[model samples]
Each structure stands twice: as C-alpha cells, then as structure tokens.
Target chain A: MSKYVMKNLSDIEIIESVKRGNTADYTMIVDRYKDRAFNLLKRMLKNDMDAEEALQDSFLKAFRYLNQFREEASFSTWFYRIVYNTALSVIASKKRKIEKEMTSLEDMPELISYDREIYATVENPKDYLMRLIDKLPIKNALVLILYYIDGLSLNEISLVMDISLVNAKVLLHRSRNILRDLLLKHNYQEEIL
Target chain B: MNIDELLNDYIDGSINANKINELKELLEKDEMTAKKLKALKAIDVLMRTIDYEKAPRDFSEKFAAYLAKNRVIKKDRKDFVTPTVLSLFMVVMLCILAVSFYYSYLSINDTEMISGILLDIFNGVSFIAGNKLFHLLGASVSFIALTILYIMNETHRRFRKKIKDL
Candidate 1:
C-alpha cells in the first residue's frame, strides 16, 4: 500500500490488517512511533545503540501482545507505556541510578551553573537548551520530551510514565523552570525574546 | 497568584483576557517578571521546536523484514497448526509405506495391485463393521485419542512459544 493509504488507516485498522495476514501493514505502526519513542529512549538511556535496541524490543513486545490490546485505551498511549517501561529496563540493566521521584523539590528548579565547556561546543541557544534538558533528571527530561516534542498532555504523560498527574505537572514545571534559569544565567534570554 | 504561576498560565494559553492584561501589566512594571517571561518563552519555543531524533532510516522496514523472517502472522496459532499437520502427514506417509511393502511381498504387479489392495481393504473394513457395538466403541476411542493428541500438541506449542518469546 502507498504511504498515504497506510497513514490514513487507524491504529485499529492497521492492527486488524496485521491479524488478517497483511503482516507488512505492521511497518506502518513501526514507522508511526519509532522516531518519537527513539527520542525518548535516547534521552533516558543516553546511548544510541541501547536506545535503538530498546526501541526494537518495545515494538517487538507490542506486536507480540497486540491481541491483548483493549479498544478503550488509545493505541498511542498503550504503545508509549510499553516504550517507557522498556527504557526503564534498559536503564536498570545498565545499573544506572534512576533519579527517584522526589515527593517535593524543596529547592525547586535548583540546577547547577551552566557548564562553560558545554557552552563553548554548541552553536546556538536551541542546542544549548537541548543539552540542558539532556542533563535534567530522567523523569524531568521525559516529561519535557513527551509534552513538547511528542505533543502529549500532562495527563497522557502521567499515564505513560505511571506517575500521578501532580507528579507529571511538577516534573514538567520544574524542568522548564530549570531550563529557563540556565538560559537567563547564560544571557540567552535576549535571543529567546 | 504568584508571577511564576501567572506566567505559566499565560504560556500554556490558560490565562483569561483579564489575566492576560494583568500579566502584561506585571511584565511591564517588574524587570524580574519581564526577564522571567522572556526566558520562559524562549525555553518553550526551543522545546516545541526540538527535533525528534531520527531512528535509523530503515527502522520500520527492518522491523517488517524481521516479522517476515519469523513468520509472525498470528504465529501462536500457526505454531500449533503447523506441528500438528506435519505430524499427521508423517503418520499417513508411514501407513502408505507399510501398505506398499505388504503388496510387494504378495507378488502383485502394478496392474493387479490396485484392485487387490482395494478389495483387501474393503474386506478388512467390512469384517470390523460387521460388529456394530465394536464399530461404535472403536469410533469413540478414535475420537478420544485424536482429542488428546490435539490437546497435548497445543500445550507443547504454547510452552515452546513462551520460551521463544522470553
């Protein structure tokens, strides 16, 4: 099928096609989600190879359990849940410490001073901000990517990450403020304006 | 509300008309609020424009190829169906071989073999069917035996699928 027709098919339609033996239709699902999920994994794992592997693992898993899918939940959210959990497993396997979800940030938006060395290497304020987000705590960076990059809402983010809505809001606000503080400190506020 | 909350609502498009004017007044009057607004707007702009890290260019194609290699079209049901069909095919082959071997020992040429074999099989079946009670009992036994075989084969297929999945 043409990419246009494939894109027009709903998730349920694609899934039904897959079940009906047009197995190639599954490529549409993979194409639809791979980049966004890969971006999330890249930030979480901080390694390209690991992120790609985790991305493959998550897709394989979602395909395997496609029958278990319930129609009530949006497929994007369900698939994101798989991608998020797979990234966590990769993190755990690497023995990487997941920054625990703090009940509250007493010193909210407390970020270290912008690294001068990092400032020297990057070209623009956008790249600088990306690096700053990369340096955020895992959950915080995730909340930012989901909301801004993937255009997911705070409620959708909470569902994907298995956190409460309040935690999701806090992570997003805290991460954004942290980036804002870093930008102000580095005199990138003018460029932003 | 604090200026941070107000700025956030403004950024999120949640600030009402009245709140928008209030925020504008706050931003104009306070250097700190003005600076904060600029930074927040910058960060929001940068984040919204952030590029999605491209997965390998052939990612979906590679995954589709992988699915084809694994023959993953409802593979669970296919897994069981395949083995059971192969096993029954083997059994039929064995029966055919045994019948041919018996015919060879009886010195029948190809010309006589077909009718002889058919006659012998017909007589054998008639002898068995001559006893209605025995015929019914044999049919019931065959049904139970086939059901058990199906159940056993299905269970084995599921177990293997689980192992492979893990």
Candidate 2:
C-alpha cells in the first residue's frame, strides 16, 4: 500500500492487522512514525548515523515484539518509549566509544555550525527573540520544541519525556527563564510587550 | 508564594483568577517584576516561532529493512518449543510407547517367567495411567505418575508466571 493510505489507518486497526500476521501493516506504522521518531532520536543522540541506526533497531525490536503489546497505552506512546530507549542505548554506546577513543571536546568535530544568514535575518524584533531561544541547554531545547514547535501541552510533554506533571512545568518555566536571560545578554532592546 | 513562582504559574496559565489579580497588582507596582514578565513572554513567543530540523527522507525505509532482518532472526529462534509444551509432548509420547511395547511383549513371550515380567509391566503402566488416589495407595505406577505430575505442575506454574509478566 502507498504510504499515504497506510498513514491514514487508525493505530488500533494496524495493530490488529499486525497480530493477524500482516507484516505489511507494520510497514505502515514505520512509515507514519519514522520521521518523527528519527527526529527525536537525532536530537537526543546528536549524531546522524547513530540516530539512523538506532531508529532502525528500535523499529525492528518493536515489530518483533508486536505480540507482546498490551494496548493499555496509546500505540504512539508505547512506540515512542521504545524509540527513546533505543536512542538512549545509542547514546550510551557512543559514550563508550568516546571513552575508548580518549578524545577531548577540542578534538571532536563540531556538529552545530552557526549560520551567518540566520544571524543576519534577525532584522526584526521577533527574529531576535527566536535567536535567543536557540541558545538554551539541550534538555530545555527539547522541552521547548515539544511544547511550542510540536504544540503539545505540558501534560503531553510529561508523558513523552516520562516525567511528572510538576517536573514538566518546572522545566518549562526554567527553560523560559534561561531564554529570557539569553535575550537580555544579547542586549535585545525590543519592547517585549 | 513568591513573585517568581507567581510569574511562572501565570505564564503557564496554571494560576487561578485570585492569583492572577494578585500578580497583576504586583506587576503594576514593581517595575523589575514587570520587566521580568515581559522578557519571559518574549521568550515564550520566540520558542513558539522557532523551527526544528527534520529527519532524513530514507529513515522509514532503512528502519523497515532493519525490522525485517530482526524478525527473521526472532522467527528462527522461536522454532524451539517452550518447556511446558515440550514436557506435555514427551508425556504423551511415553504413554504411547509404553502401550505399544506391552502389546508387543504379550504377543512374543510365552514362558511363565517372561509372562510374569510382562504382567508386571502391564500392571505398572496401568497404575501410572490410573487415578491419583490409586497411585497414592502404593500402586506400581505411583513413582512414574508422581514424577510426571510434578513436571507437569511445575511447567504449568512457570508458564503462568511467564504469561503474567508479559
């Protein structure tokens, strides 16, 4: 089936088809979630190759154990849990590799390059505000992305990150404060009403 | 509680109307607190406007290939029967073998000594296949049946625990 057609099916129907040995039904799931899962994994792992490999591994594990799924949780939530775990494993594996390599931060290749065009585009007050947000810590970055970019609520972020509601709120508050400080440090003088 | 907590709650929309009124009064009076709130609101807007990087287009295809390979491996590993099923199959096989052997012995043996041995085997097999109460009364099948019963019970218990964990 085409990716669009497969993506349109409900998760429960896909799962039912999977249980009946229709492996192609699972391909639909992979097609629907792969980009989002890979994006999350890439941000968490901070490497393209490792994120890709981990995303593949996670999908395989999820497919192999489809029969064990209990359906008590939403399919996306459950699948994301697997993806999160796989990304964590990839991070741990990379850490081990780095320790073996005995490389310092200075020796590592820079993954994030600052773009002059992006910097120059801050001609408007709103652009300056956005630039400041990009300077937050990775965890804060993820929280901001989920809450703002993905339009998920704090409760949904909590479920995705496996944190409590109070903690999610605290993280969001802290991230906002950090971003505000960054903007002030940059001498952003726009009347932020 | 404090200005910071109130501001945080207010920005997140978790503050009650009473708290909002109190915070509004504070913001009206304190220039620094008001400035902080403004900065925070700006940051919130900034966050809402930022775009994230997208994952590559081939991610799904690669992930599907990996999953297919893993499935093949899992299927190969699953060919072996579970312990419970294996034990049940063994018990059934042994029962059939014993019955066949008994019939064969009766057809071939005619001497009294051999006949006696054959009768003993038949008695033992019958006792093993009989009621638990009969076995408990020291019937010849007592040991064999007890052993099989223990194996079966343990297998069942373990199977139940495994299922529960899953």
Candidate 3:
C-alpha cells in the first residue's frame, strides 16, 4: 500500500502493524519524519553524511524497540528524543565540545540606523535567519530549531532535549539574545527588522 | 521582570493583561527596552520562515528493502519461540524432578538408605583420587596451558616478522 493511505493511520496503528510482524509497514514511519529528523541531525552534526547515517541508525533503533513504546507521550516526541540522543552520542564520540559563546555588548554598534531601501532589497528574512542560526552556538541553534521550526511546546522541547523546562526556556531566551547580537554585529539589526 | 523575560512572554503571547500593562510601562519608561522588544519581535518573525527538508525520493523504498533483509535474519534466529519452548521444557522437567524426589524421600522411611548413598559417593571420589586420576587431570591442564603460551608466542613472532617484511 502507498504511504499516503497509511498516512491516515495513527502512530499507535503503525506501531501495532510493526508489532504484528508487518515489518514492512515501518517504512511509513520512516517516510513520514525522515526529513525533519534529518534536518535536526544535520544541524547537530554539522555534516551531511553523518546526519544521514544517524537518521538511518535512529530509525532502525526505534523499530527494534517499538515494543517498548507506551502512549505516555506522542510518538513524534519519543522518536525525536531518540534522534536527539543519537546525534549527541555521535558528537560525543568525536570529542566535540559545543560551547555557547555569548557575544558581548561591546561588539554591537553604538548607533542603530535604519534605511527603507535595505529592508526592501532583503528578499527573504527566513532564509537570512537560517544563515544566522547556522552561526549560533550548537545549543542555541537546537533550541531555536526545536521551538520555532519544529513547533514544539516548551514541555516537549524539554523532553526532547532531556533538560528541565526552566532550562529550555532559558536556552530559548539566550538564543534570541545571541541572534540579536549577531544581527547587530553584522549591522542588520535595523534593516532586517 | 527582566527585558529578556518580558520580551519572551510578549512573543509567546503568554502575558496576561497585567503583565502586558507592566511591559508597556517599561517600554515607555526606557528606550532601550522598547528597541529590544522590536528587535526580538522581528527575530521571531524571521524564525517562522525556517522550512523542513524533503525526504529523498527513494528513502521509503530503500528503507523498506532494509527492513526486508532484517526480517530474513530475524526469521532465521527464531529467538522468541526457541527460548520460550526451552524455558517451558526446563520448568516442567524441574517440577517432575522435585515431585519424584519428594516421593522417594517419603518412601525411604529409614535413615540407613540415605547414609549408604552418601558413603557410596565418598568411596567413589576416594577411588578416583587413589588411582591418580586427579594427577592426570592436573597434568592435562598444564599441557594445555603450555600449548596456549607457545601458540601465543609464535603468533606474536610471526606478526612482528610480517610487519618488518612490510
């Protein structure tokens, strides 16, 4: 059957299908969230090949342990948690330290000036924001993507990131400040806004 | 209370009218707070523009093939059924053994038979020790250990030689 037909099936149903030895049905789950998971891994690993491999590894892991899944949280949240930890392990094994560098206010310009022509010429603020997000520290980048791009609530983001809710909120707050500082440093604070 | 918290609440729309009034008062009181709010709001707008990547066209097909290959291995293992049957069989055998032993114990009303069986086991062990079978076992174990050491040394020597030749 086509994945579109299976799209209407709930996660519980898909999980049941896999449990019943309809292993092929698992492709539906892979098809649904591969891109979103890929993007998260890509951002975390900062490499295309590593992200793709992690994505595949995570899917296999989720399938292998599908019997342990409970309905306490949404499948998306649980699956995302697995993907997050897998990416974290990959980063850890490589001995990469993802430190958040707080930009000092001194790096910002003294005066904020705006011009109408600058705003008019900016084709896509979203695309511009993506580039800015890429420059952010890993932790801040993750929080921004989880909160804004993935549309996860604070509680969900906390679970996925395996941090406390207060920490998640603080991370989001810090991410905005960092992004703002970046804009200031680049002198796009007035024009982009 | 802080500018960051205030802007976050404002952006999330989590602020009530009282908090909104407090924020408004802060904005009017300080130009810096107002400018910060404007910049944060703009950043929030840009954040929404981030898009999701599309899965490769062959992702599902490729993954399905992998699952198929995995299923073949899973079928070959038969991990679930074999272990379950083995466990059940062992439990039944244990139960039978326990029941039979209990019945035999009950039938043996006299203590003489129990002492006789224990004495027979002791004599059998003594016989083995007297025949020097224990010495034979020790000698065999030593031989195996020496063989293992010799093989290890030879392997190491050959490995070094191979490396030197390379």
Top-scoring candidate (lDDT): 1
- In terms of DockQ, the best-performing candidate is 1
Candidate 1, residues A97-149, lDDT tens digits: the string is 99854323334344454445567789988888788677677888888899999
Model 3 has an lDDT value of 0.78
Q: Which portions of model 2 show Cα errors greater than 4 Å?
A: A1-5, A96-136, A187-193, B69-165
Q: Could you tell me every candidate's TM-score relative to the true structure?
A: 0.71, 0.61, 0.67
State the displacement of the C-alpha of residue A154, model 3, in Å, after optimal TM-score superposition: 0.8
Between candidates 1 and 2, name the one with more favorable DockQ.
1
lDDT of 1 by residue, B1-166 (tens): 7777788778878779999999888878899899988898888887888889999998887777776778665543434777899999999999999999997777766767778888999998888889898879999999999999999989998997578546
Q: Which candidate is the best by TM-score?
A: 1
lDDT per residue as tens, model 3, B37-101: 87788888877877876556676777777767766315323548868999999999999999999
Q: List residue ranges in candidate 1 displaced over 4 A.
A: A101-114, B75-166
User: Residue B84's C-alpha lDDT in candidate 1?
Assistant: 95
lDDT of 2 at A1: 70
lDDT of 3 by residue, A1-193 (tens): 6757688998888888877777767777887789899889888888887887788889988987776777788999999999999998999888998654444333333212221233345566665567556655677788889888889999999999888999898888877886665565455657656
Q: Which parts of model 3 have CA positions greater than 4 angstroms off?
A: A1-4, A100-124, A184-193, B70-166
Give the Å error, residue A31, model 3: 1.0
